[model samples]
Target: MKKFIPLSILLATLGATNAQADFQGTPTTNAPSWVTSWDVTVPCPVYVSENQADNIFFEGGFDYQDARKTVDGALGYRHLMSDNKVMLGANVLYSHEFPRNHQRISYGAEIRTSVFEINSNYYHRLTDWKLTGVDQNEEKARGGYDVELALAVPYVPSAHFRVKHFCWNGIASNIPTNPIDDLKGNTFSVSGSVYDGLSVEVGYIDYTSGNADYSKAGGERFLKVSYNFDIFGTHVNKATKPRFSNTPYEFERMDDRRFEKIRFEQKVISANKTDRDA
Candidate 1:
């Protein structure tokens, strides 16, 4: 819209920088090519049967992420099992992370078969997670979880294969501070699909494990652009093919690993970069 206000003032005049430690981030909001980073899906309406699992649908997703200012909202439900190839899903999530503004709630589940897909997610951090901004809260435990495995090969359905595992500051509440849990992360990406909604991805995130510290190494490359929707016309994957957390590049790669726990829990790493890890 109006070229997103001069690319949001050139990404707020380039905020975080340190060349992004190799996890790839180099000022990008996709130019006058603005969509201002979005992820939206709406699919509600059902009734058409032959007992192919009755095929029900209900979807909703709202996300805004331009490198780090992430905002998310989602509500979902999908089903198509009855021996018709299987498909199941559930979602409920809310996120707000920006410059360490922390706020979170998450839950996800999935199951698919047509070419295999499995996803699981859990992130919790309702406040207090600042890294350079303050508030440690003992690394604010009790938040982090991810596991995804995807593949869609077999005549090139659109090309896909994803593998992900991440854990950032987990389990340990009731007030404490400083564990950071090494902020584990692992990623792999490959996606290509263009026609129905939109998708494009390229992945790599393993900045030498945990606390990303790479000056210019061999790891750190991630890029993605995703969009999803099916509002009033409702099609719902036509039967199956959108599980991995709303598949549109795996929901921005598991919502950008919850903003990489404030972008790699900084040790001096910041820059207007993008390749997918907020």
Candidate 2:
């Protein structure tokens, strides 16, 4: 009963929290002409040009620990293709210890379609519990892998210019250990925001595994909530025709030597300013 209680409580809390996080505004194309879709997950790096690369996201949050508080941090990257119809990215998360005191790294990729998106994630948990000649209480749980496949669809896209809804289904499991494997399961998620760059996600998970007969009845469920921040990329169209104007700052690549001279003059001006300030 005690074992079941901890899992039950965790699912309830995170699930409830994620529901609130899913409340975001409608999708907008104004973000960037190159952006394919709204970034609902961690970012992944994809290079589009010699100088144009994808943006990555960094995240942190708080949780409970040995009768106190703890913190968790994550980082990820995302990229959009030229057609602006496909998106891809990856992310990793690590949380401090509560009872076991360990760190976990999770990374995966996501592909987006017009109607839905598919996600494949892999994670491993690492802990320092014991050593060959160390203290008995110094044992550790090294590394393990978890794989989850999820399918999500945007239902309403955006409602009242305020809320957005999405539904997902798939399976998740610990591939390394059969004890924590989940054979069948599904997840429900929603997201929205009060303003740009500020949003939330609410998720509920229901899963069943081979050990369900010996495990708790009703399978298992969890709730999660999260906020996201965005970093944008800068890109230029090198293949396009050039347009020049007779302005102090207006010039074309045809006059590269002339611009080089201008750049030298600007450097001299900047150096003079530094000297005067000094």
Candidate 3:
């Protein structure tokens, strides 16, 4: 009598090997350093005042490449205080890139309290940067902060997958509103378009106060356009077809008969060889 292997055992082994071949989707989060990004929006209860003015405003940026552009996606949560008149919120954003000779990941967090009843703009970018000069690579580590107030609605509301529109009209002033110097100004901006990951804004700004001076040469409006794709980053080629053709059902039966003949011949040959050696 001869021992035999179970079909279940063969299937279990094959399943383990196939599990390793599952595909993972490409990354679409990282972005270049020159890009300035923000996930800002105005929720309900405090509708934007600009919509009544018949003007629009917008600002946004995005870049994706075949794992080359990097990824900076975020998850944010907000809580309504005083029935949406006040909001206490926290946001987390991160970006990563794993490419040849360069592996970098950056993240940031923010906790803000705002009173929509009083137009306000409070945003800060917390990153330590090393600025390297041309002659000798220089790097400076520092964090930047921006806090301003507007006479109009402080939050602008817009959405993806919709016709983009945004506008902001407010008297903006720096941290210290007193003496107001060159730090105070009135700004009005308008923009409209769709979200293909690019945005532009144009506005008029004027400022005048004791120890303050600012000007926009006949309404400051500048054009900005940026696009990114992912070829420089990584090799992501894969084959979908199997390397060897599978045995047909009928051919499998033929294989079994052929295998039995080979087994008998091998046993006879082994016995002959043993006798000859003896």
Best by lDDT: 1
Model 3 agreement with the true structure over 75-100: per-residue lDDT tens digits: 33334333333333333333332231
State the displacement of the C-alpha of residue 200, model 1, in Å, after optimal TM-score superposition: 36
Clash number for each model: 13, 33, 21
Which RMSD values do the candidates have, in order? 17.2, 21.1, 32.3
What is the alpha-carbon lDDT of model 3 when measured against the actual structure?
Answer: 0.22
Better model by lDDT: candidate 1 vs candidate 3: 1
Per-residue lDDT value at 86 in model 1: 59
Local distance difference test scores for all models: 0.45, 0.31, 0.22
Which numbered prediction scores highest in TM-score against the true structure?
Answer: 2
lDDT per residue for candidate 2 within 1-278, as digits (tens), equals 11112334533664442211110111222222111112222222233334223545554555431132334555656565644444565666665544434455555566543334455545454543323232332323323233333222223221011111212111222343322222233444443333333343344434333233312322222222222323332211111112222332311222111000000000000000111111
lDDT value, residue 32 of candidate 3: 24
Question: Model 3 residue 43 lDDT?
Answer: 15
Q: Which candidate model has the greater TM-score, 1 or 2?
A: 2
The parts of candidate 2 lying over 4 Å away from their true place are: 1-53, 56-70, 128-155, 158-184, 193-203, 210-214, 220-223, 229-278
Candidate 3 regions with alpha-carbon error over 4 angstroms: 1-71, 81-88, 95-133, 148-199, 203-278
Compute each candidate's TM-score over C-alphas.
0.26, 0.42, 0.27
Tell me how far the alpha carbon of residue 57 in candidate 3 is from the true structure, in angstroms, after superposition. 24
